[model samples]
Target chain A: MLYLVGLGLHDEKDVTVRGMEAIKGSERVYLEAYTSILGVGKERLEAFYGKEVVVADRDMVEMDSDEILRDADKVDVAFLVVGDPFGATTHSDLLLRADALSVPYTVIHNASVMNAVGALGLALYNYGQTVSIPFFTDSWRPDSWLERVRENLRLGLHTLCLLDIKVKEQSEENLARGRKIFEPPRYMSVPCAISQLLSLLEEEGQTPAEASSDDAVALNPATTLAISASRVGAPSQRFVSGTLEELSKLDEEAFGGPLHSFVIVGRRFHALERDFAVRWAVDKDNWNQVSNGVYKVRD
Target chain B: MLYLVGLGLHDEKDVTVRGMEAIKGSERVYLEAYTSILGVGKERLEAFYGKEVVVADRDMVEMDSDEILRDADKVDVAFLVVGDPFGATTHSDLLLRADALSVPYTVIHNASVMNAVGALGLALYNYGQTVSIPFFTDSWRPDSWLERVRENLRLGLHTLCLLDIKVKEQSEENLARGRKIFEPPRYMSVPCAISQLLSLLEEEGQTPAEASSDDAVALNPATTLAISASRVGAPSQRFVSGTLEELSKLDEEAFGGPLHSFVIVGRRFHALERDFAVRWAVDKDNWNQVSNGVYKVRD
Candidate 1:
């Protein structure tokens, strides 16, 4: 049987009781590395599962998925992922391969970052389309995500911006030249993302449009945001709040490390949520005022 | 300290180890019952956590949040949710109340249905504005979600249609007279959702537009979907595959029980993903034939 288990956002312990059981019972365990990295390293997962785990990079999964499924058909092979088994489409490919090989499979689900964004106190239902803010290169800055955010704003829905994380990604030149060089994994910070959004809005001449809408009245340079940093499921989980402009101004020391994401508040806000944002306020910069009763309307 | 923990989908075992610890350590544990419910009931969670849990209904939370946050300043208190703590905006209000009471708060995140739709082998980055298809009433067959879905289709982005769930909802007469009459919690099924979608499309006269748009290829009844039913994190978890049209024909027996949701596949499927879908084909019906290759491009 092939088992796909989600390790969740943090360290080894973040795996659900069921996921741990599947990992422990498997004869061979492989961790899909490129799609996403766990807050903790492979060593920690190995120690917790009490089994050696082979790291499966993009090459191993894409170029040699057949072999992985072949082995699983004979013995229980567990492929562990950072989030839920199907969190990324790549993992679904693995499951499809297992099914093609006539191998019995079981998927053990766990928390993934997709839903974890709710930590910012936004209603999941009220959230519109989620867009990923990629790290901008000197020559390439995609404003495609701007249209999505605009639509969500128009619908009075919150937008969950998943920051980009590039791991084991090869440069165009390196890939064309048949070199094995890879850029370092990058996890976009919330502040950097907001700055990019502001820049894109200005570029598209939508700065005024973004600012003038009643839904976007709370957003500005000094507008507050709930930024979550650190490994969520890890021991050192951290969350901070500040305006978009102030968040960009603060140094990395305030956020403390990798895998950070941001939430852009929408027009509506529940009284409790507004108070929650106030606790994470950036001192005197309080341009983003949540209205009196935002949660009164039921979705 | 106040802790908001996500129980994830499904049963008690679905709770992350960190969430379990928090629940065990808390002096008082309150489970929010309005937003969503687990596969099992209060007794199951109480048995698993080895602690007495109080059901914080909507009225209790809206009217008497202070009672739950009263001693949070002194001792640890946990508010358990079906998905992530922030999945529903109500918990954010609870946190704000805690902040107002000067209670240090922490959120233990978990996966909610928001992103779990990626299980269908669709790229998370390509999903556009999500819409909620509410259960239609005699006088209120809302079609607002249709416009949002149509907009998403125009942009070649996937639409995550979150089916509505009605829990402890009152009848009009009961609400008008202020009575305690309540109906059974209702979870929107895939069939009902599709029927509504098709009817709304017909009403809008966008059937041909939706059916023949080269740009809106991702929006189709035959588009691949992850039809998941039952408690995802529970032992009885069940997931199936089919087009919206095909899925709408499935009976309750095959779909299992409550808390069912689906994901509509978007364009831009990876080559590896296209090959994977071929293996999940049931009988003579192929998902690929239904929803032509949205991934094919001349680049």
Candidate 2:
């Protein structure tokens, strides 16, 4: 049996009973580490589950996946993901592989940041397509996500920007020379994502020279209401709301830790949502001024 | 402290370790019973946690919310929800009420149908705004969701249509005459949802004089590819994919059980998603015909 278990957001205690059972009973346990990370490390999960866990990086999962599935037809092999196993495409590929190999698998579901972002006092139903904001390189800066945000705006729906996490990634020098040296892990912070988004808007000619006065419209740097949330689904989860420019100028330390996510507020707000947003705002007075004053609302 | 614990999708065993601990340690445990339901009953939850779990229906939650939060400032109280605590707006209301009463709370996250829908071979990021398909009566057939689906189609993103579950609902006569008699719970099946959607499109004149030749776009009823999944996170989970017209013709038993969710495939497709969809398809031949033949692909 091949068990694709989700170690729900936060620490080891977030693992469900079924997932824990899969880990304890499996002959081999592999923690998928590249796509996302929990607050606790592999050692913490090891101590909690009382089993040795092998950390599977990008190479091991993408290239050496058959090793993880070896003997799975005879014994239980648990492949653990940070959140829900289906958050990334790699897990789907693995499921197909298991089907081809005739190894039946079960998915033990857990909360991912995709759903956990609702903790910021936003209703899940109001969100549009979820997008990822990657770390901008000196040479490679992708602006395709800008159009997605615009599309969400056009439809009057909020967009969830899942910040990127680069784990065990090598520098250009190492990759070009076929070396194995890896750079330190990078977790995109809320402020960094805001700044990158602002720059991308400018590059795409979406950000006007003079920002719009409307405080609620997204893609407008000066006034668009946005949220910066970190450590969601954890005990220390924190969320702050402000305009895009203000969020971009704030220090990353204000958000506390990694595994952050950002939200671009939609133009269409339910009456209850306005109240909810105010209650969860960073500065209630400022939120009130912006939301009640100039937040351009559509139906 | 009030613990808003999420009893994740499917069964009692799906609860996280932290959520379990919270349930055990709390002085009072209340299982929220209106918005959604777990596969198991309150008895199963009580047996697993070894605590008396009181079921809080819509009346208890919306009308008597103060009862749930009473004395929480002094004693630990656990209010359990079926999925992630924030999937419904009522949970947010409870949080606000707690805030009004100066009660501090913690949210223990768990899997929700919002993210669990990804297991059906579709990427999470590709989904557009999630919409609810409420049960329609002879008089009230809300078509607002139709516009949302159309917007998703316009943006080239898939739409996740969450079927409605009516729990502890009173009949109109009973409600008007001040009676407490409740109707049996009704969970909208996949076929029911599809039939409702098709009728709605026709009612709105979006069905056209004749159905389009296309098999990929939504709102056309005939050719739009869709997926019907049931018990997404459970051992007995089942999924069937076909064009909207064919899916509407399928019996409810095809999906096996309740807690079903439906997905309307987007006009755009990644090549990998095509293969994944085929692998998970109920009839791979028909899926290929719709996808490979006239299915529109937009970047």
Candidate 3:
């Protein structure tokens, strides 16, 4: 049997009791490492589970999945994911492969950022289609996500922007020459994402429709309320709510580490939700000023 | 410290190792039992952790919370929730009470239906604002959720409709007479939800706006595609996708048991998602005809 176990969001202990039991009973355990990172190291997980975990990078999981599924029909082999097994499309693809190979599998579910972002006091039901913000290169910068955010805003739904993390990425030159060398890992921070968003707006300013009418754009950085959260589901997690302009100018040290997420607050706000979210603001007075100005609707 | 530990979707074993450790170390463990149900009883969880578990109902949690948090400042107290601790607003209110009392707390996150619904092969990012369907009565049938569904459809986003569960609820007469008598639990099944939705559409036909134009309405029972899932994350889980009209007539026994969810498929369909969803259709040929006719967009 092939076990797709979720390691929750934090350290080794985040794995469910059922997941632990499966791992202990498995002959081989593989950790898919590229999609997300855990707070603890591989060795810490090995020490806790008393099993050597093979680290599977993107190439291995995407290309050599057969090897991971090898002997699974006879023995229990565990493939561990940092979040829920189905959090990423690659893991779902793996499940499809297992079905094709006639290998029975069990998925042990855990918390993913898709749901964990509710910790920000925003109603999960109020969120619209989530968007991912990739690191903008000089040659490649896409602003398609802006449309999604706009649609969400039009419907008074919160937008969760999942900041990108580039791990073991190769440069264009390296990829062209087929070099195996990888660059240092880079995790997108809140300020970086805000800057990209601001640039997109600046670019939109040049467009005829945007220049002719201010009402055409849904979001204005100076007035729009947003929340910047870092290391959610971790003990040291921090969240700050304010206007986009204020968030864009926020100090890098305010959000201490990797895995930052941003939420563009929608127009609809329940009094309770607003009060709860205000408690996490970097500047509570400013948050109230901007939020009240932007979100006039009340429950 | 107060620990809000999540018992992931299924049985007692679904609790994380960290949650188990917290339960074992706690002087008192209370399971919040109103928002969602667990496959196992309190006794099973108690036996698994070798600790006395207290079942905290809605009254105990809302009215008698002080008793639950009594001496929590000095003793380790664990409040176990069926899914992620913050899945419901009540839990967040409890957290606020803890804060008011200056009690430090830790959240042990686990799977919630908000994320676990990804088992339907739909991208988590593609879902819009989730709506809940309450049991319809002769006089209290509100169809506000139809507007949310229409908005999601306009944005080409999937809608996850959470079915309501009435557990330990008192009848109007009993409540008026101040009696403690409770009615038997009633979990809204897939068929019931579909019937309610269809009825809502039928009611819309009488409205002036809906009567004037057929294209203004977003959902059609005969053509709109949807997925019915039951006992998700449990071993006996089942999923069947088909047109709304077809699912409205689905066998009650086909879903197995309670905790059923319905996903109204949107216009956006990645070819892969369409293929994956079709595999679980009750009638593959009919599903293909309906889904293709409705969700024509392909990526």
Alpha carbon lDDT of each predicted model? 0.70, 0.83, 0.84
Of the two candidates 1 and 3, the one with more favorable DockQ, higher being better, is 3
Best-to-worst ranking by DockQ: 2, 3, 1
Position B205, candidate 1: lDDT:
59
RMSD of each: 4.4, 2.5, 2.5
Cand. 1 TM to true fold: 0.84
Tens digit of per-residue lDDT, candidate 2, span A1-299: 99999998889999999899999999999999888888998999999999999999888988988999999999999999998898755377787888889999999999988888888777788898888988898889987887788788766778999888888888889999999999999899998888888887676566444433432333677667888778888888888888788788888888988988989988766556667667656667777666666564322
Sorted by lDDT (best first), the order is 3, 2, 1
Tens digits of per-residue lDDT for model 1, A56-158 = 8888988898867776767888888887777654476667667778888877677776677666555555666667778899999987777677666655666
Error of 2 at B64 (Å): 1.6
Candidate 1 C-alpha error for residue B93, in Å: 1.4
Flag the better candidate by DockQ, 2 or 3.
2
- TM-score per model over all chains: 0.84, 0.95, 0.95
Kindly report the docking quality category of candidate 1.
acceptable
User: In candidate 3, what are the lDDT values of residues B37-86, reduced to their tens digit?
Assistant: 98878889889999988999999999988888888889999999988887
After the best TM-score superposition of candidate 3, give how far the Cα of residue A153 lies from its true spot, in angstroms. Answer: 1.1
Per-residue lDDT of B1-299 in model 2, one digit per residue for the tens?
A: 99999899989899999999999999999998888888888999889999999998877898998999999999999999999898765377888899899999999989998898888777888889989999999899988987788778766689999999988889999999989999998999999898998887776566444433332343666567888788888888888888888888788888888988889988666656667777657678877777766464322
Our tally of clashes for model 1 stands at 0
